[model samples]
Target: MDRIRRRRTGAVAGTLTALALAVTGLFAGGTGTAAADTRAVPQHAVTGYWQNFDNGAQVQKLGDVQDDYDIIAVAFADATGTPGQVTFNLDSAGLGGYTVDQFKADIKAKQAAGKSVIISVGGEKGAVAVDDAASASAFADSVYALMREYGFDGVDIDLENGLDSTYMTQALKSLAGKAGSGLVLTMAPQTIDMQSPSNEYFKTALAVKDILTVVNMQYYNSGSMLGCDGKVYSQGTVDFLTGLACIQLENGLAPSQVGIGVPASPQAAGGGYVFPDVVNNALDCLAKGTGCGSFKPSKTYPDIRGAMTWSTNWDAGAGSAWSKAVGPHVHDLP
Candidate 1:
């Protein structure tokens, strides 16, 4: 999301990587069991990011996040000194004095309640790259270790600056092979990164669509981009959401694999923040061919996956206005 900072920091240049996950069903007794071979396919999703640090918005325990959220992605893991190596720099200091064990326990509680807690790689200024097979293998191996050690359900790719589709695809395939069917592979590419099917991000998404869970393209912090209709749509409007999402839906991506990602509050992004109603309207227009704005999709994507937000912490600061309003609407969509 922070393209400017990534350019100036020089951390974004390196390449190498790996990541993967395994299913552990949360048992009632604070213990975990092997995940069911067939888990419920999520028809509607409400995904939120949990920043490990306190950033003005009230930091929350992983379990304290609202139950409405189906998937909770931890903000980031710092790309380390080795290419494809990363580390989660968490501690009692940033967690309001809660220890790492307590944090892991809370993550378990959420998982027990049928919610997923995955590690998100990258952010406004994440410095991770997977540009070759060696780096790709390293990235997968490191991520798999993290998922095993921390009990994460999966990994979320949110690389902000850019990606190499060739190697990223290889890294993701390796990750999927290790994690198996229970792994939830999601992405949060910036708007420009996903502007068209020809883009690297889109190509990567397509390359891994079989293993991919969803592609929540960030619709915030973007100025303007061309829609499927070839007309430019400015962000922060209903037209922008529908028009842009149309590109993915009309392309190779199944409706269920596409989600519209937005900021939980105006403060969550530099620009392109719209009211929750605008988001719901876009959903309705895309999935039901109703509640449309000026630019409506030529075909309805009735099974499109639900919405995603930048951070649940910001939503909490705004009295959870975004989730409270949009979560139920997504659930009700037919």
Candidate 2:
């Protein structure tokens, strides 16, 4: 992926929407002109991933927070972007046996507990629901209704592996219809510019930046192996930066829409792994002598929003240390 890629953290500070989104607030239906507003303002709601785990029992466990991150993405394989092999059952990971009532209740509980959990669909897992566009639309309709039924603040289309724009666009549109003007719709895709990412993920996102909140570009690793190492490596600083820059520059992705996240396993983790990208990035930063547990703005791209790690459980002092750097990147984003 692009070495010019990125990551960072912080509380939903005061300055976030204050600078960039102010015009939208004033011109956005002409609601207010003199009040400094703040309260669940989905304005640049920077995201970080929580890979897999339902009910917050996994890494997002109720009492396991080592530190605070801006956004928490809950893994729901059913909502995944896996190719065209998805079905109504989806991947069983997202819907599982949990009904809409049960799931939404969980979301409400998490938010009440001071944590923001967004539903993440599409991943290395198996959530693809069939290649047919109709099927995809149906799937999106169901998920969109579910988001409403469950009261989720937003949805994420993490086509980490499957699906395409045709279906993805339908799905996003479905979610947005039910969500209306207040809900969020995001997509996470690889930085390598593809023709169509996640059912027109790029085009649709640009077309509807108002609803499509974040376009998290996987920067650390993407495409194929560096050789036969069978392991993924972080793109050098220049490659990463340029790659991500290309994504935003051409895709019509807003500076706020573009996001950076950690891929688990400093090496390759396609199998079954649950850990934060902090350790991996930190280790690489250490080897590169850039020093781990730090966040820096891209000299060329300062409109960056937020950074995310694959997993969250602090493995060692390294993971905890990286958490400390989250605030600087998130709060100081341009």
Candidate 3:
């Protein structure tokens, strides 16, 4: 998969017309199924992005991904001619000729197993931006339509180049209105994106903290970033993971809202991929205050959501080494 490099990178009900959506708050009237959002936003969770293309990595159906992965984020949905205008470009040829309906059926199978599958936007080369209200609305409408069309549980924001906090917030708020209860909103910002609370991505996540599910900051393909202790930490270390994650946990996000994002293997990213055991050590140091590697969180985040990886395809290539080793560790986190 040729992903855009800055890093990486939902639906609704009727009676949920735009007008009615406007008046309702984010968590307004939701059915039992809407509770899907709450469960989808899991604790001690393991998330993996599935490449829509073959990319030399194993291509598995949505329902065939490892059982330990709680959330499976589909690689990307392209933004069309206009800013925020978007459409999915699933290459049936690349997908082993899996038809759209087959893909949709697989998505339903995943949901039946209690896993949340969502569409991820942006990659190393993704072109998506929400600079104003109109663009924001276009983003909301287009993404919502994809959710309804594909039976997706939500959307993941992985815009690598840049983002507009203000309008992106507007678009998400509008999207939440449309998605109502089951809406799952997640984010995958680069290491620098979370170095401070004021950065565009950080601001956007904080702005929608109420409706936001999780913010999985990509810790791979990054060189160095400022930790919560106001010092810089290089990648590929537990300090790098927990310290940067501390910025979000202490700044505003609940423990459950922050997840440590990394690459499944060195081949999965340009740089900064650590061994699975190292990833688990970082999780332990953060969630339980043990396994410290130089820098430790001032306080443990027992409720930290868990970990996220760049691509599940790469994990399969490694004989599922990454998920096999890390998934159970994340699940056993304090």
Candidate 4:
């Protein structure tokens, strides 16, 4: 299988809605307009991707998503014909006739329940590019527009193709300026993209560290990588999760800003699928220095953000086993 054929199985049309320039002074700051009312993410949270197109996994409306998932990332916002522009098309027909108005209402319901619904851009086949300043502006403007149109709390950068740290950092900062402090910025860089602080993805994470909510690096599809201790660890093991996470914790990311992302099931990725117990063990090892494999961190990160999965739909297909086990564990972390 191709490395880039991991998540997002089908394509959806990019439909950009015309956003009104109307501003309501509901809150302060952010470009002289009221900021978005983004819900506060938990100290230790669970993030899951909600698939837009049916791909054998469970097809769900935004409201039907389980409460265990603190952050519901709507997967694969399509890259538009314009450079760096993206738009979301709800697969109403494919999703059993789910409509745009219903989708927006569901997003509001999630937020009211203290869950964040963010638009995830870029996947295995994602080709959205923000390489230059002009494209960077377009990217930020379009994403912010989506946030307003769809009632999204923020944006998730899952661009697998490639990224320019300089412009991405600028784009995110510009977005935060418009969205205000409530912006919930998150990322899902591949394991290789974050092996070192010098890498583009890592650089962008560090650049926007203050505004960044979490960097849930996809710990699957990554065969083997060097840990912060400079030891090579293979995937599908506790060492792979804890060891690789140490790199981010030790390098620049705060304990609260680092998260371990794993596949929801064996079918979720090409490889690197660990059971819920293994994920729990990794979390324990990182947070409290217990349940570890061979490699262990020099220090414990009690405030480590938490865990994430490729999708919630897969967990539902498996009777919600992933979230049923991992969700409480993440919330119960000390």
Which residue pairs in model 4 clash with each other?
A: none
- Give the Cα error of residue 141 in candidate 1, in Å: 0.4
Error of 2 at 202 (Å): 2.9
RMSD of candidates 1 onward, in order: 9.7, 11.9, 9.8, 10.8
Q: Model 2: runs farther than 4 Å from truth?
A: 1-45, 54-67, 79-106, 113-115, 130-133, 193-201, 223-239, 264-302, 314-319
Models sorted by TM-score, best on top: 4, 3, 1, 2
Write model 3 residue lDDT over 1-334, tens digit each, in one string: 2453223320122312322322222222211111123655566688989888877677766666888798899988997998897889877888788788888998998888888999998877777989998999999999999999998899999888899999999999999999887888889988767765667998998888888778888887766656666555778888888877877777678777888888887777777788888888888898889988889866787777889987788888788998999989988876
Cα lDDT of model 1 by residue, 1-334, tens digit: 4322111111121110100010011112211111122133368788888877776676777777877788888888779877877778774686688778988899889888888888999887887988888888889988888899888888899987779999999998898899888888789988777665667998998888887878889887667666666666778999999988887776677787888899888777777889999999999999999988889876788788889997788888899999999989988889
Off by over 4 Å in 4: 1-38
Candidate 4 per-residue lDDT, tens place, 205-320, comes to 98888788888999887666666665667788999899888877777777888889998888778788899999999999999999999988777888888999978888888888
Candidate 1: TM-score? 0.88
The whole-model lDDT of each prediction reads 0.78, 0.44, 0.78, 0.83
Stretches > 4 Å off in candidate 1: 1-41
Q: What tens-digit string does per-residue lDDT give for candidate 2 at 63-162?
A: 2444355556665535335433222232235324444445456567666665566666666553465356776566666666555555556666665444
